[model samples]
Target: MIELKREGDVFVLRMDAGENRFHPDFLAAANEALTEVERAEGPKALVTTGAGKFYSNGLDLEWLGAHQEEFVPYLESVNALYARFLELPAPTVAAVNGHAFAGGAMLALAQDFAVMRTDRGYFCLPEVDLGMSFTPGMSALIQGRLTAPVAHEAMLTGRRYAAEQAREAGIVQRTADEAGVLPAAVELAASLAGKDGGTVRAIRVGLYKHVIAALRGPALPE
Candidate 1:
């Protein structure tokens, strides 16, 4: 469910599955694509976006219902994915082409930069409305990525932010028309591709050291 494409020094990973929920196969494909990007030589950057109306809808509740026994482990893998993005050796951007809700929103936060579609889609955290609480790792990730005031409002109120609102809130750095989202993200990534990958990783790892720790530490509190 991941399509990898090359545009100059940037690698674009398109999530093709509908809604791009975090199912086992979907996660596997995403991680596998990441691995390829990590191992590639020379100058490179990464951009990820989804096909059609969903950047991602987050957790696959239906899959979780059927695979109850895998719940904790499944969340652990999800946390790991976030950590991987935080510490990726090259610059990374999220081209938020459509709705990014719950964990999907957090996935975008994990990226170094984000370009959202202005004409459509929303960036939201609906866990509170869904009667769900954030995992420890998730809480850490959100707090680390967002300013205190914005995080407070978003986590407590479950606000659905459109592109301009999200940009104002510092959730995303840029906004573009529906057709320009990915291109803007790719352009941004391409601009940063010349930086030394090793140094980029080191700097990001240093900046988000605690966030990465929480993400890699445990999915839930002890």
Candidate 2:
């Protein structure tokens, strides 16, 4: 299950896998929590993390392999979440306290920034390896935020990377100690809280839109 809690100026969204790797009810709860976070007008920032050990181990291979019909709606649902992150007005940060796999990694990357635990886990995108492809929105996000070579590597390899490596690749801003990952993420978000919220949002929207303009094909930069 996922939980959303207000922490003064920020909100914490956590992923709890329990014993099941992929739980449909859990996913639905998480998505709903995200929506509520979006609607929380006064919260200055968002901190997304996971409980216990893993940030997320991507999809639950067993659950997914067993309940085939669930995949469609799940993927569709996550795509919608990706869109919400893209349009979110508040500054957001991911606290990758543990490993993030496939969709989990995508959710973390969708945040405006990230603080990751250097030794606890890693990041990977294995959708293609799992016989699926990342949504187009994910493609746009990677292309815009990550260097071509790095993005290409993740897409091609479907391998996980350590936090230090992710930081070097330009995905994570900093690597945190295991004990402080979420706290550090919240710290960064808090720093952004005092800025001109409207201005910050305008910049993100304008910047990504301009970036996609060229991605449409390629005209000379105006």
Off by over 4 Å in 1: none
Residue 103, model 2: lDDT of 68
- Kindly report which residue stretches of model 2 are placed more than 4 angstroms away from their true locations once superposed: 19-22, 60-63, 209-222
Per-residue alpha-carbon lDDT of candidate 1 for residues 48-129, written as tens digits (9 for 90 to 100):
9998989998998899999999988998899999999988999999999999999899999999999999999999999999
Residue 37 shift from truth in candidate 2, angstroms: 2.5
Which pairs clash in the backbone of model 2? none
Separate clash counts for every candidate: 0, 0
Which one is best on lDDT?
A: 1
Give me the displacement of residue 160 in model 2, in angstroms. Answer: 2.3
